[model samples]
Target: MTTTRPGGRSARVRSAVLRAAGDMLAEQGFGHLDLAEIGRRAVVGKTTVYRRWGTVAALVADLLDEMAEESLPRTDTGTLLGDLTANARLVADTLTDPRQGPLFAALIASATCDERTAQALHQFYETRVAEWAPCVEQAIARGEVPAGTDPGEVIRAVSAPLYYRLLTTATPPDHTVADRAATAAAVAAERGVYVPAE
Candidate 1:
């Protein structure tokens, strides 16, 4: 994600701007964010910010992509249940963290009206989900799941409730929530809820 800054203001400047945008998204939210203010907080020039992103939605989109890249890599915990449990907790912890959750919510709200922002947000989750799909596929290969299990579906299933919690309620998604998600996914897999192509 090479942000196109016209008169390249050094990598340090770019990083600072991105970090500042993240902080602003969490604090003031994208709806009311001011790029000039972001430039001041980042200690960069307004020209640099304007040349790079040109809009608040673009700034939020870039920040979200940067966050996804910085997040930890997916883990393989042996079984689908264990792996999904790990996945759920990772997502829960991320969304429930002091700074990150609000930042994400702010960006998510922005995405509702901005197509590019929405696509970027979806892509971030898709990449994460795809990273863990192999765990479910391995289970299928081992007959741990029924034949024709859709690995992608299983991966998405584990996150569905966790996302619901984030979208609907104040209850933090934790180990208990993660376990329930993993259980539901496991049961679905067992019941052939994710049948792959015949």
Candidate 2:
């Protein structure tokens, strides 16, 4: 027996459609994504997919929003190096994962040509960066870094090289890569690279 309840049904439909969209985005790239196909894959009605998202870009934006919501929070490890290392490793792992690697690449590529997608992608990064920025603030409070150092910049620095390597090369990042990124960012922050002069 099937029951039609507004809240439960709508939420499940959204989840299923987003999952289907994510799978297609990962497997075939965003260029091949289709509303009708996503609806079929999700077992949702085509009209619903069309009515809800209207376009592929909108659907992808929603998927990115969901991804941000589902991403992990930061870890606190008493030391800046430890915390940054954990953050770097998390980014490395996600960018190297079989499904996520391609999915992210596709999204990044899409953002390059589409303004709305770019905004959505930027929002996703902003959310992730904000989640980890507190670790840098904690480090500053601990006298590990200079006062007024930008925590968001420090966090971004830790993950930038890892992401660059992922986008530029076929090789997956190892633990050493994550460690190096964390160390480099920590050293830079210590040297005031992220500190803005008044």
Candidate 3:
């Protein structure tokens, strides 16, 4: 039995392949992705790429999983507003980053056309929202927001407009926009907007 060690050759190959894939996705979008081309760019064997990830959608799914795993842990700022602001700023910074922004745009575009990619994208956001949901839970415990405020909804609200702006407008979301998003979400949560219906 061949066991793959952590940080071993297999790990290196996966890292290289993922990096090459991300570069390609950022540069040319999902339509141009080919396993053979990815193999060439990653300097890995073509067969290996095909064997590991059978389809472009599968490869993209793996990439999204990797991204979720590598994402930063949530910030804890004591106050709900402060924590939400930090979360919004993180999303804004990621969406505005040169390499990551285009890569995400490509992924989101592909998701619209491919069911598997869409599932992967949905899972990515779910992971991100779950990570930040605790902030709202903390707020509830602190009496900052009404009881029964949906933590996940509050977290999603913080990022929704930023993503809308990313998709609909040329202007990238900035810190000021992030601040506004956080504030709005916080105020809404405080007013029971995120609270579940009776």
The sequence of per-residue lDDT tens digits that candidate 3 reaches over residues 80-172 is: 999999999999999999999999999999999999999999999999999999999999999999999999999999999999999999999
| lDDT, residue 98, model 3 | 92
Q: What is the C-alpha lDDT of each candidate?
A: 0.82, 0.90, 0.93
Report the error of model 1 at residue 18, Å: 1.2
- TM-score leader: 3
- The all-Cα superposition gives candidate 3 an RMSD in Å to the true structure of 2.6
Name the lDDT of candidate 1: 0.82
The local lDDT score (0 to 100) that residue 101 gets in candidate 1 is: 85
Worst 10 residues of 1 by lDDT: 1-10
Two-way lDDT contest, 2 vs 3, winner: 3
**Model 2 — which ten-residue stretch has the worst lDDT?**
1-10
lDDT of prediction 2: 0.90
Give me the displacement of residue 114 in model 1, in angstroms: 1.3
Of the candidates shown, which would achieve the greatest lDDT relative to the real structure? 3
Comparing 1 with 2 on TM-score, the higher-scoring candidate is 2
Residue-level lDDT of model 2, residues 156-197, one tens digit each, is 999889878888888878779999999999999999999998
Off by over 4 Å in 3: 1-7
TM-score for each predicted model, relative to the true structure: 0.91, 0.95, 0.96
TM-score of 3: 0.96
